[model samples]
Target: MTLHAHLTRTVARPLPITSVVIDDAFWSPRIEQGRTTTLPTQEHQLRTGGQFEALSLSWKPGDDNEPHIFWESDIAKWIEAASYSLAKRPDAELDASVDEAITLLAGAQQPDGYLNVYFTVVRPGERFTDLRDGHELYCAGHLMEAAAAHHGATGKTSLLTIARQYADLLIEQFAPGGPLEGGYDGHQEIELGLMRLAEATGDGRYRALARKMLEDRGTEPFYFEAEEQRRGTPGYFGFLFPDRAKLAERFREYNQSHAPVREQRDAVGHSVRAMYMYSAMADLAPQLDDDSMQAALAELWSSTTERKMYLTGGIGADPSIEGFAGDFDLPLHGAYAETCAAIGLVFWARRMAANTGEGRYIDVLERALFNGVLAGASAEGTHYFYGNPMLSRGDMTRNAWFGVACCPPNFARLVQSLETYAYAQTDDSAVINLYVSGAATFDFDGHALGLSVQSNYPWSGQVDVTVNTAPTVEKEIALRVPGWAQDVALRVAGEDHQVQVHEGYVRVRRTWRAGDVITLTFAIVPRITRARPEVDAAAGRVALERGPLVYCLEGVDNAGDVAQLSIGDGAALRDEWDDDLQAVRVSVDGTRHLNTSSSLYSSAKDSVEDATITAVPYYQWGNRGKSTMEIWIREDESASF
Candidate 1:
């Protein structure tokens, strides 16, 4: 019995970049900025950061610069981002740079198809000896992903060839009956990368290898512990982690290897790694027809989104381990919502949507995309936020680059690949997952169907879609009804249409038409929302949400400090536009608790004064210089003075 013997999964297929064109008021400019500004800045950073130079295997131990074990992965991500940009709009200079990078990687690959700059140049002849600490397989995974993206964009096989060779080597070294059987990378990403390679090359070997690695994980005797004993040292990161016992005590679920994955219930460990692992599991569950894996995925999805996730769709509360803490332990002032983790959530959410054909996953995807993921990078697409805190005290700001620059490139890739997330299709139906203004062409049994969507989503819920199809094609066009919206109305050609809503989508079945117009409306309005009582940090506090954007009060916008502002019950809220931001802002009536008495332990009550609070979208915070910011506002118990 083998995992690969099961039937292949049937998931929704996304339209290719060639078949979809995104021309809209909101996403068009951002997509262009991703290609023009973000990609160039990342390339320059890679050159200066020694990522491109390290591929020559020239750095020494005592040199001014040392090659990092994870440097290759950074460059690999940039390559992937650039490849996506090139696919949409070809640029000669960008193509040349990609070619140069491929040349460097090709030169560095060993005869055995193994690739890693640190192990090759910094410590030769000691490869694959530190699976617990070293990131060799992780880097290989990124390379494989970059290779698939490059091949898909340019139809070039140079990087694909190198990726296949390295993948072959990995199968030999890590597969069952291999010398190093039962081995798994400490950081998960290769699983997703292997799945990408399998799709691109039509090779089942890569997918099987991913399954084998996943199945080998969390097995007894724990390969990492045994590998540490063999090395006779704590590990590379021994100083911070000390020993396995101390590491286990401090970080309860280290890398999510505490138990067999199918038996695991909670979402724990490194936030980014956990998301990657769960994403791969969601992808493989249907293909293998494993009901247990799907159930496990559902449990984890609830544990993550229902309890651990932030209002802005951010995850990972504790900064100490860059992972999740106890349920409902979300602290607004000190949050570790890494940018990569948000992107990982988007990936997993999309896969879950494909697995179940449900609209709830898409809701999470939209939340993360609009708030958490967009907040990671600045509007200009150059500066980035490594950790997005729910509350900022004039100290949190964007940086041009970081020592570990993983978030920038990861953000770039997701922004450039936005079109694929907007729409999906099957043999007899076309699904609109996101309300982005774009045009997508789908072919069903040699008949073509074209759909053009127009709207300013996350701002207005009025989506106007025009469908064009061949005379022979008569299929269903499904539009997703957002979970947050209310009083949804749908009309076909100016006539109110009554349709059955199933699984959060309104499915319309009709004969072929050339210019059939459909109007879907959901009144977008400002509302105040509160977290569960269990979330102690947000007790008696409410957050503002308009459409999909979460609004936050910044000191620059309201008074000089937002820490004392409290929203009274039945506060009047209105939407206004900020000239500087070119986006809608929220205005509300509140009270500010004034500091009166000077005595430290005085029992005197602080005087309250009426105040008008101005709030901007959470994603746009920190862009207008650092200032005090808070998402959850204190609630005033009394409505009348």
Candidate 2:
């Protein structure tokens, strides 16, 4: 596994953010809103919350809002998101603000390149003592990612210089035979961040360090357990749980250290941690050409998306650990599908798509992008939901901020970097992974190839691709045919081509000319979807799906609580445009069960009446004020009283 091995696995490269321009009716405005509204609002929150000030190392003991172990990562994610937004749409005020934060961070760095405010300012000598709860490496990973993003966006290496210094320190202290040998972060993030750093710096050492960390994880004599024993205390958050015996097991599994990374096939532990770790594994497997690692990732992906995932593409069911429950234990109302977890799933999905060149990964990516991840932020972009629940009891609503704010910045960065996920390219070919309306430039054998896409995706299934400029040499263009589409019709310059699908992509190879047009039409009609019988919660229920969007019934659209509504399996559904939402709404023939007896545990069945149920996109549910929302509706029965 050397740099040569990494180069050999290159299949397709995501077009740089600067090379693609998004002019979408659905996504353009949201990206702009994230830039103007979300980033600014989040910056204010970070500043007011003392995160920015804490970067200055000014916090003293007993001070208000004492710097927490994870605060740096929050601000680092914000900086990364702000950098992406700045890359697309520059704001002088925002740029200056980022510069100021970088200055503070640079000033806070220790002489040895260590840079964590909590350890440096609050607890000076306890730097690497408690890796399980310190979050030191996790914060370093985020800073490294932020530095890479900032350097790419502005071409300024000030942040990168600081990040690399810290990374070098980490490698020296944590690598084999080093002082912190056999130790890794309690949280699984630095591995992914090291990969990014390697790309940013064009340095193989970072990649080597990442590989070492991954290989070292899940080996005999767990690092976390050893580190915990060295501390000789329960570590932080130990007092929260009463049972000491169960607490040890919970702690080990919660951080994903129960088994070795390669042998750990099931998607266990904290959902976000598992996603990040699996994402790093997927990324390195191809680079290192490790077959066993790839196999483990595939099994973990199935365990996650197939058995543990919700209809909305949301993972993690238990709120207690803010992570996963057992298999098929998904509860619609009690779901703790954190927005960051969904974003991590998207990260893993994109890497998997690149690794295997498969469209199935894109299907799950699109599902989470439209529902689980998009539901995190409000339409205005100021408020956010930390946990996205499929069934809300009229109480869950977006808030301005949280004490431990992670999702807002995570959501901001993902949407800002949406263009990179839309398409990937190599020297002689390109792959369209998403259907967002955008224009992109790619290299075709040293010649510039220009392409523009036009589509009303998620709302409609028609897409038209035009080649503005092409090379004389023949090149291949691969368009992903979504797994959910019943059939896809393809045409090139008014000529219908045989729909020859390979590995879930329709690859068209030819010498392109200017003004050449390619058209794709998919059967994106509303359809009923049912879960597996193993899913006890949704065994007798069905959900609605149109294209990649999952539809949910909201109380505001339905006039009241939607808990009692039931749609028949054979009921007819119509798609109608709504003025309020400005999106397609699904109307279905349903029956509402009214409890006439009104007694607790009554033997008498409830009476039912005909109803016209209105459903909106799951992503657009909580926008119309607080309302009851439900995704899985009970199947209508013939014997209703």
Candidate 3:
């Protein structure tokens, strides 16, 4: 069973959580926290934030509060997270709460199968009137995802029934000749969700709807243009269309629809919307055998990774559009690397990996997973930053919650389903994706299989795998040697052996025994990573990375003025233990630049002395209270100070 109902994944199938067990010290506790603390806290935030009351059918005509159009998606995500939790760890009370929410949400559905809380409770007559700003379909897509998750978690179809009714109603309303024809949700989610529903319940109608939604976009007598004409468009991108000269041309750029999806290349528009659409395209292309669609995804991957992405795997170069600006337009401090967008990147990358039998997809996935996605939440597992910036000046801090708090729950759901991303299985091979200590047992070609893994990753590069209860046939195990790893060594049965190393993984093909062990090690040395010169904001700056962890200097440890410091050289870095954070600290030789200029602008001077400062992992910052924080530093290009 795959996390997504991706029956068409060409290269590999992601074994469900039931097929694997996570027994590691690192992920076990993290998953437990998500189950106990994060899920409950999100529920409380939703309840206190008036989500239940907002969606309730008991609202009077004179109710003062108008529901947020997108409020239902938040509840949908919460139920999805809770459903994932209930699948692994059963809880009677939590189960009851989820069922209760499902019942109330169902009660709010309109007679026509349209299930939007805002239109039902707030504006009854104007349902689906403003599709661009309404978010009716967006909310439905998330609820459909929740329905699929609930079915997987509880093995029940109560929520799935609601989603089916919603899907049928949507199909009736938006079919080729229906009233909503030639229209798509301004947000790109329903396409992915429809595909999930089609897989969950073997109905081709949903997939048909999914394809129609994508196909109907960017055609002549444009729906966006017509909708903008009727609504007098005022939105940032999708809303105001006819207001432009070349209407169809510019809307495609904003919607990643310049041409048909298969023809579009560079990543564009709202970062999250574009990513969600791209992920669905990747999932559908192989099933339809559409090579052009796959080619578009490949082109997009190169454009985003090689130029637009940050060293920390963050995206979104422009804060105004909450999307990309141009090639190599990465800004350090002013960057709006939305957490949801980065998580969306993981979805796209994983699908890309499954489509193409390559390990470079895993490289991009691991980098984003370790840095950008992990940096969304604080250490306490509660506070979150909606937008993650590479540089923070003693002011950027996480909030308990936000008005549009999509990122928090979006991340919570991702953390709950970590098992699916850990490994992918094929007929004769099982790929080790992420190095969290876990024991996975699954059936391969009608034969029983068992494998156990141990690692102290990021902090240490050594990984040990034991072929416990081996397969009857020769099963090849491909271990991902991360792109960052250089000097990697592989050993079998305590004896050094050379293996066929491809793209970015070392493949060991052998028939194994229960006691047979394989050992692998990668040098865990701190190295400096520099930004491309085109990124003017980070021209002379460099960041430090060891293994998968990106290091950052906080003001509290560096005399409260982190900007005054410059990195001397990566070779001078040394590791030390930090009792406060309960993690390793890396310190490097540097110099504190003297602020000798009387005016704000002056000639650069080298009045400095030798100094050093400590740095913590990017994920560990803002825990000791807010202070100046920076990932990139002034690189000592000439010599060690």
Q: What is the C-alpha lDDT of each candidate?
A: 0.87, 0.87, 0.81
Task: Please tell me which model should have the higher TM-score, number 2 or number 3.
Answer: 2
What stretches of model 2 exceed 4 Å from their correct place? 1-7, 242-249, 639-641
- Give the number of colliding residue pairs in candidate 1: 0
Residue-level lDDT tens digits of model 2 in 1-641: 33222434556678889989999999999999988889999999999988998988887888788898899899899999999988888799999999999999999999999999989988898899888778898999999999999999999999999999998998888776789877888888998888889899988778888888777876778777677678877666655655755566677789887777788788888999989999888878876545888888989999999889988888999998889999999988888999999999999999898888888999999999999999898989999999999798999889999998989999999999998899998656788999999899998657877899999987888899999989888888889888888778999989999898888889899999999999988888899999888888887898999999999999988879899899875888899878778789999888888897857788888888888899899988799788999999989755232
Ranking by lDDT: 2, 1, 3
User: Where is model 2 poorest over a 10-residue stretch in terms of lDDT?
Assistant: 1-10
Reference-based lDDT, residue 176, model 1: 73
* Alpha-carbon runs more than 4 Å astray in model 3: 1-9, 60-62, 230-251, 569-571, 603-606
Whichever of 1 and 3 has more TM-score, that candidate is: 1
For residues 1-641, write the lDDT of model 3, one tens digit per residue. 11122245467777787777887766787788888888888888989988887767666667666578888899998898888888888999889989989988878877767787768766676776676667778888899989998998899999999999999988878886778877888788898889878978988788778877776665666676577677664543344444665555645576665567777778887788888888888778777644887888899999888978877677887887788879988888898989998888988888898888588888888788878898898877888998989888988889889999899899888888888888888777788888989887757867766889899776788889988788778888878888888778999888898855796678888887787888888888777888778888888888888787888999988987788888765447788667777677998888888867788888778587767778888878888888999998887766564
RMSD of each: 1.6, 1.8, 3.0
lDDT (tens digit, per residue) of candidate 1 on 39-140: 899899999989999998888878977988899999899999999889989999999999999999999999999999999988888788787678888898
